[model samples]
Target: MNKHFYQKCIASALALIMFFSLFAGANPAKAEAALNINADGAILVDGETGKVLYEKNADSVLGIASMTKMMTEYILLDAVKKGKVKWDQEYTPSDLVYKISQNRDLSNVPLRADGKYNVRELYDAMAIYSANAATIAIAEIIGGSETNFVKMMNEKAGKLGLKDFKFVNSSGLNNRDYKGEQPQGTGAEDENVMSARAVAKLAFHLINDFPDVLKTASTPKKTFREGTEDRIEMINWNWMLPELDYGYQGMDGLKTGTTDFAGYCFTGTAGRDGKRFITVVQNAKDSSGKGGYKARFDETRKMMDYAFSNYSKEKIVPKHYQVKGQKTIPVIKGKENEVKIYTKSAINMIVHNGDEKNYQPVLVLDKKKINKDGKLTAPIKKGEKVGYVTVKPKNGEKVSFLTGEDQIQVDVIAAQDVEKANWFVLMMRGVGNFFGDVWHGIASTVKGWFK
Candidate 1:
């Protein structure tokens, strides 16, 4: 064929290939429903990445019942860490604590108005038994009074970026006088309200910040105020604990909630093979036509089982993983003209079963950060972010197959320190590079002329 004809044919073939490549890679896969949980609101999140695996009415705010104590726990634990309260720090309960303790209608750890209990005892009562009076006493100690404590709780909720959440009391117990920041009366109507998403976020924050809470919460049963006359037995209400009938392996301690208005609710967490999951269910009902806590545990088990059975932790980008095929980045005024780079931390992802083999992540580097000359300023500090690697679906259709469409951006940083170049080193390198560039240019020109 003539040269012109040959070139035209090649162009036509390349155009056809390009068209098919774009068409095949542009379609996004639709995410299918994995689990159908029975609840008014629910959420499941990957513990390590905070990725939402499943959610239904997760943003609808309603009364959270005793689960509000999770916030109480977060605040109390934070106080301890900040030296605001000691494990042995004692607090004097007011008449209100005694009233709540004696009110049989509510859950309480018997409190003596004149008696002083340490922070640790109160925390145990609240975490294990969901004692309303103990929660109040601790809140009072933390914020000087119940009203002030509620304010602190709300403040914390705000800091956690929780939306559609309101704290009327430190304890989740209903107060008739409080409603969404407005107190009407002293009846059993006022209660702290939050959405499943907000609760899940709070739970994530709790475990991420104060992991010690799990130690107390995981205990199926323990004695509060041990070795003292005031000591009382505390039983964990979370039936998902391994010792319970509905228990499963790896299931640890979390919080549970129950009330006429809130029905049965639970925030559960479990770990296996270094992968952890957190699930929250609200207003769940039982299969036996009962409207009690059974449904909460039953539904929680289903969600937990589905997650544990289907998902796994995969290290997509391992720490110190060299960027394959990446040209060495040129360093300006450094001891060397170029430097090698590697990932600072591993990029792990929670993927469903079968997906570990199918889902492939593409590393997208910032074009601006990579210049044509591949040059970078020297004095690079180790772990200092230099660019970003966006982890996206290798196949566009896989976008829908994943939990979220948004790409995970990992900061690509310098793996090691690159010291500034001395003046003598710079001068020597510059002369060497200039000659190298000239030699390469002449060699390339001569080679092209021959071709």
Candidate 2:
């Protein structure tokens, strides 16, 4: 294949691999399979539980188009959460904002350079319409300047544990100098990219950390009729909504993005029977780029359906649980004779019912472990981490890492250092100690009563 063909082929192949890895899970025969896609990277995870249900190159960093808007939402909502801004706060657009909003990379908010909008309208334009101008307006309102706001965005991402992505601009529009010299969102400075997993994670924070934002994002089929400039047509780019697909009625608001470097991308959420899930699709094809959102909607539905149909978040093993280890070891002075280590996640693997028996929990003990056995000795302290019990769905499941328990400080010590004497000696000592103890006891009793 030519270099162009090679790149295209790799992109295609990577998309497929990531798609299967994400959605398919460990079981192949389970009928609850999701839709397939050509996105270079993808991931689907339970939003409420943080369980990764399906993931494509979910970890592979790729350009995410307007999905950057979600970060904008995060920053603004974070401000709202901290009382830095509010739903009704009004902000005026500066000339720099107006000048930048006019760029083709932005959605026309119809606001003049000096036009003022409340936080509500700015949020609406930005969330519902993915308005670039609205983003600048919101950024300025929150950060006192676009540069300052973008700085805050990067900081928040860091605090949230988003390592692969960064922001150099508020709108994520690639800035190019007069010579067209700077690359599009690919400059040495333009480092705004994220993996599907991280994007879904950020969405998790957005929906969970600030549900009000989701309330705004989920406004499917909003009618933008501002001052009647022909009520310029603006429809949600996400198809996984009631207005677009009845089956996807349970789906809620999220953000979408696309850039040639990142391809078509979306970070979305949906629910069914109280079980909600988040999804990320990167380099998912609009293949034609005419906005490949339809493919995203279709693929998202498949993954969500698969999750609800096959998995039910069952708690298989209750706590106070121990997955017997491969070997038991001695501790120095622990209250318990031996410590049991297990996996931290749970004995509950996302397995199909048919193969449930095939999986076995393993007692995984590490040779390096050496804690005093609780039964030996201690000023028993409760809740001190001892060791953990872990379970694996399959025996050879890479010997899933160990999980340890806090040393449950039992009240009694197993053995005291005081020694026991022979019968005769014990008798003599007992008689002597008895006489002394009795004399002392009587004396103490008399003294206490007198006092």
Best by lDDT: 1
TM-score of each: 0.79, 0.66
Tell me the tens digit of each residue's lDDT in model 2 across 159-215. 887767867667655544112322223354463687776788788888888887777
Best by TM-score: 1
> What lDDT does each candidate get?
0.76, 0.63
Roughly what TM-score does model 1 have, to 2 decimal places?
Answer: 0.79
Q: Model 1 clash pairs?
A: 29-397, 175-190, 176-187, 176-189, 177-184, 177-185
lDDT of 1 by residue, 1-451 (tens): 7999999999999999999666433321111244667888888878766777777888898778999999999999998899998999878888777777766567667888788888888888899889988888888888887778878888998887788898878778767422233222223566678999899889988988888788988989888778978777877899889997678788886999887777888999988888888889999877654656788888888888877876778777777666657524677876666666666677777776545444443444556655666677787777766665545554434332112344454667776778899988888888999999999999999999989
Error of 1 at 27 (Å): 15
The segments of candidate 1 whose C-alpha lies over 4 angstroms from its true place after superposition are 1-34, 177-188, 225-231, 287-290, 324-327, 357-375, 381-385, 388-390, 396-411, 415-451
